[model samples]
Target: MDRFVLTDAQWAKMEPHCLGKPTDPGRSGANNRLFLEAVLWIVRTGSPWRDLPATFGNWSTAFRRFRDWREADVFKRIFDALTEEPDMEYAMVDATIVKVHRHGQGAKGGLRARPLAVPKAA
Candidate 1:
């Protein structure tokens, strides 16, 4: 219902391992439909897990599942499985390009680098 649900085509594009499978009895529970929906929402909207809508189930539950999946190497496996292999025959080629006038890489600044301006007393 107006949730960031994944279309059939998109779901099919994902790795089979990432898809929901038949859950066993007892230890098995309600399908993780809402959980997957929440994850899809996050991937689509790039929002934090805590920002997940309550309608998609508890944010903590979704986060826990995410963590579990991550710990179980599900994410990597999914990525590998869904990814297509490059089409290239057995061939080795190398090329080198020369460039002049190179500058040092920029440094990353931290929060400490940015300070709020102090207001003057009126």
Candidate 2:
């Protein structure tokens, strides 16, 4: 199963905001898209960096790069770029599917229960 989360259009939107273009002074990122995918995979699966797939390259390297990007606000820039035109297709919440338990609906003897008064000291 393909685990990649970024579509080509999304990647294009975020590409310019990523660090390490050949024009930058420091060493360019080997493959920014793959690195971003690695980070996304970790997030999507809620897995620790140590469990990153071998296809994403060394887990440590990916983690370190993620740290750098976080500190540099690269991810924020990418998010901003993508949100320029938000997609609301999956944003709706269905009220019918949501359930309120009896306790949650202010059932008797819950928060309404009065606390017993402390005995007066002699």
Candidate 3:
């Protein structure tokens, strides 16, 4: 799979916030750019971690790294930094184009009138 590549401007924004730099105390990450690409691949394709391509390294290692970064809030920081300038121009949504499934419309009797039983605690 062709991995996602961050633009120079985007990388500049995220570089400082990422973990495992050469100056960092712990074992340095193999390559922050490649790691980001691996993460993007998972998110973009919506694939299970185990399906990660061999070029990205072991799937389990990537998943563990992802968990560690999540715990440290690195993803949130990157999002905030990159989205600092809100692009309101493209924010408008056309509700008319949206569709809802028939079964999701709720029962004929409505929600409140439906018979609901409370389970007894075991």
Q: Which 10-residue span in candidate 3 carries the lowest summed lDDT?
A: 22-31
Task: Give the distance in Å from residue 44's predicted Cα in candidate 1 to where it truly belongs.
Answer: 4.3
How many steric clashes between backbone atoms does each model show? Answer: 0, 0, 0
List the RMSD of every prediction in angstroms. Answer: 16.1, 7.1, 11.1
lDDT of 1: 0.65
lDDT of 1 by residue, 16-119 (tens): 66534556442113355556677778998999988998887778877877887778777687667555664555454444444433343344542356567889
Q: What order do you get sorting by lDDT, best first?
A: 2, 3, 1
Error in Å for residue 108 of model 2: 21
> How far is 22's C-alpha from truth in model 1 (Å)?
4.0
lDDT of 3: 0.83
Tell me the deviation in Å of residue 89 in model 1: 18
Report the lDDT tens digits of candidate 2 across residue range 1-122: 26567888888998899898755664345788888888889998999999999999899888988998999998899988888887797787796768888677875666556779989899
Quote each prediction's TM-score: 0.52, 0.66, 0.67
